[model samples]
Target: MVVNNGIANDARVIKTAAALRRAGAEVTVLGIATAGGPREETTAGGVRYVRLPVFPRRGATAAYLRFALARRAAHLVRDPRRWQRTLPSLRWYQRAFTRELRALDPDIVHAHDIHLLDTVARTWPPHRCPFVIYDAHEYVADLAVAGRRTRREVESWAAKERDRISDADAVITVSPEIATRLAAEHHLPRRPTVVLNAPVRFDGPADPGAPAGPVRSLRAEVGVSASTPLAVYGGALSTARGLGTVIEALPLVPDLHLAIVAVPYPHPMSQELRELATSLGVADRTHLIEPVAAHEVPAFLASADIGVSAILGTAASYDMAMPNKLFEFLHAGLRIVTS
Candidate 1:
């Protein structure tokens, strides 16, 4: 059971599934099936994908228009109506998710995150689905819900996460921090495995046409003139990511332009960040680009002086939360500053 077969940008699942198949294991993805996925439903890689209804998201192509108009996309879903509208879609995703997994009859089922734990647990027949692994991507339990949800809502989600981690044959998390916390917080029979979310070691062709002339051309296109240094921040602009710090850091450097290449995670804080940049009089130097794919990251990182990854010390952050953006920065041979 590939619990996180949800998004194309979810490169971990995709790569893992492919890797498993290449290693002589048959893999099936229980995820949202977008138009971009192989139409045959199963890839030649011995990997099959089962589209979960709840995971209906527009893929990279649809991502093109995410930030448009005088306004870019909203970074957070702060409105009440959005939640009401989102509930029905959630139900569909659940139903589609359960049916497909049940049909797949995987020997070992792995659910990626606390939200899916209960659903997977209920779906698994007693003594069947022999191995259930609760893969905690982040600490759902510790997440401070934003905008409107009550403490009860958070408690319910956290409880479910706890149950999932406790009940699974094995609990797997991305970092030691989450692993240690899970060990202390739950009644798991044994310790959960900690698999750090490191970036794939790049073995691709070096310098894929990203040279000086093209780099300068990109600089010119984004209004970053020859004299300016570029401080690039890539990836989600969520509250947890600590993007405000990046904006605040901008005021210290007069000869720099801030290039943010990310689809702002839905939040009011993101809008506020933009406003903060404007208030600081650095808004003119802000170059906002939409999200790029995992593979295309080096190209994005190429136009930067330093890459920033600021995840304010969440325990759920398994082992320093080695987000690939940090790795991409390293791969692109750019300097990086993180918090």
Candidate 2:
């Protein structure tokens, strides 16, 4: 399996890997290395994860230095080709992934998103290529981009997916709506399999020494008494999530406390939400918690009074999708309040 970002916080990827492992298949997930994380590690379940670094180095510091130098060189050269000059670091990672893929020589290749769809398709000739699975986590073609991507770039992604999607032996997506759209748009032979972004089922209490550690209740973690009314939202902090709406509405329900367990905390959006809460005189009732481990989420959120998915109609993708946090909340036994 291949993904563009670090795999630590991706619940979908983690769950998929675990399921495949339980089915007696060997899985190796190739993902981009994040700062201060290991380049390679094996999970407790024995699935191997290889994180391709942007530079050839064992230490994160050295890798960052080399990447910074490459970016500096790209600026100095000021090449007319925009991609070549602006994305030297990305190119390095791509080259590294390609090299790693060749070394693995697996029987099946799973491309996690459109970013690596073309790369995996072109890795080998059609006659001897592995059975490829393209997993679309979102409706990439019509995904909402907020100032981070140009229209041309978004179109290029759509084109890339359209071009290489036929090469995939099977396709998987997070929602039924996305699966139907993919088949219609790409003219696939069959609708892609719908795999809702659900949390892993728990048959019993997790072992104490588990990777996630003992389940820590949200109220305890946030230093709130058991009687405190807590509404929690867990996932990426973005405008698309309509978090600002939640913060703005806090004043209406003065007794209710909202906790946002956001990935990559101290994010710009989280800061903005905090400021908004303060302006509304509900700052004390708002809590910002760093994201918990993927396996630990349901347990961690079990004690919260409510789970909120205030997703805004910011884009077509957001409107047609089912957010995974909803399922996590269900598994945790929390009542849901969604938009």
Question: By TM-score, how accurate is candidate 2?
Answer: 0.85
* CA shift of 186, model 2, Å: 0.6
Which 10-residue window in model 2 sums to the lowest lDDT? 202-211
Looking at model 1, residue 247 earns an lDDT score of: 78
Residue-pair clashes, model 1: 10
Scored against the true structure, residue 184 in model 2 reaches a CA lDDT of 98
List the candidate 2 regions with Cα displacement exceeding 4 Å: 35-38, 55-93, 202-213, 266-268
Best by lDDT: 2
RMSD of each candidate relative to the true structure: 8.4, 4.2
Model 2: per-residue Cα lDDT at residue 284: 91
Q: What is the TM-score of each candidate against the true structure?
A: 0.71, 0.85
Best by TM-score: 2
Q: How high is the CA lDDT of each candidate model?
A: 0.60, 0.78
